[model samples]
Target: MPIQTRLFVRFALGYLLLGLVAGVVMAVDPAWRFLWPTYLHVIVVGWLTQLIFGVAFWLFPRASRDRKRGREGFIWATLVLLNVGLVLRILAEPFDLGRAAGPLLMASALCHLGAAVGFTANIWPRMGSGR
Candidate 1:
């Protein structure tokens, strides 16, 4: 597997653990329920989505003999943006409900959007394209 794939999968596993811990904390103390959204994103976007991306990157058809896995830079950008967005969201969501952290939340959303676009752009060419 590519190093990028490994990084993404590893991060996904870490996020899964983080999400589980967050869920348990919320379960033990309902007061921590404000983190519900954060927990969901961590599990869904951080774990599930990243895992899917990593696997797809590894399994997808090669764009060419010289360039497999599409674009390395885009993959790296996707990984970075996704994690940055998730981290930003986690840190900013529980603070003042975005009254003070509104920009941060917006930036996080943009980062996620960028990640999605980057992943799509990188993978689209490789989809169904023979090796």
Candidate 2:
């Protein structure tokens, strides 16, 4: 699998583990104060968000097809920053310092966003309406 695909799979597994653990926690201690929110942040921001981004970047039209300058760097940086940010978020949330993870995640999002835009630009020319 491509690195991007690997990243997506890892992110998915991360979320699944978090969910299973959350379920157990809920079952054991339904009165936990931060159950839902904590889980939401991790699963949504840390997991699903990363998962979607990785998949989008991996499968995005022209993502792998284009070998132009800086494309690989952008994609790899996206993978690194996304996972690093997610890890930071996961660590920060439990200690009530989740804000610490915000910047990293934002940077990661920007990288992925740039990659998506680049991919779109690369493929757009090939997608004409037969004009």
Candidate 3:
């Protein structure tokens, strides 16, 4: 596997562990119930989506020579944005951080959206023409 693929997989595994730990904590302590959203997002977006992205990137057809696997920079950006968004959501949502967290949450959402766009742009060309 490529370096990017390895990184993605590693991230997915790490998130999976974190999500599971968070879930267990929430289950064990009712007071921690507010963290459900954080755990859910950590598992879904951080673990599952990232795992899919890594596997898809590894298994998908190669891009044409003209494109060269879309753009390495964009893929890196996607990785960064996705992680940043997840981290922001995890930090901001679970605490009673008050109004200060609003902008952080919004920025997290934008980061996720940007990551999706970046991943799409990088992967589209690899889908190959019907011919």
Report per-prediction Cα RMSD to one decimal.
1.9, 5.0, 1.3
Badly placed stretches (over 4 Å) of model 2 are 63-70, 96-131
lDDT of 1 by residue, 16-129 (tens): 999999999999999999999999999999999999999998998898899977888999999999999999999999767537598899999999999999999999988764
> Which regions in candidate 3 have their CA more than 4 angstroms from the true location?
none
Could you estimate the TM-score for every candidate? 0.94, 0.60, 0.93
How does model 3 score by TM-score?
0.93
Give candidate 1's root-mean-square deviation (CA, Å).
1.9
User: Candidate 2, after superposition: displacement of residue 31 in Å?
Assistant: 3.9
lDDT winner between 1 and 2, please give it: 1
Clashing pairs in 1: none
**Whole-model Cα lDDT of every candidate shown, in order:** 0.93, 0.59, 0.89
How do these models rank on lDDT, best leading? 1, 3, 2
Output the lDDT of residue 61, model 2: 48
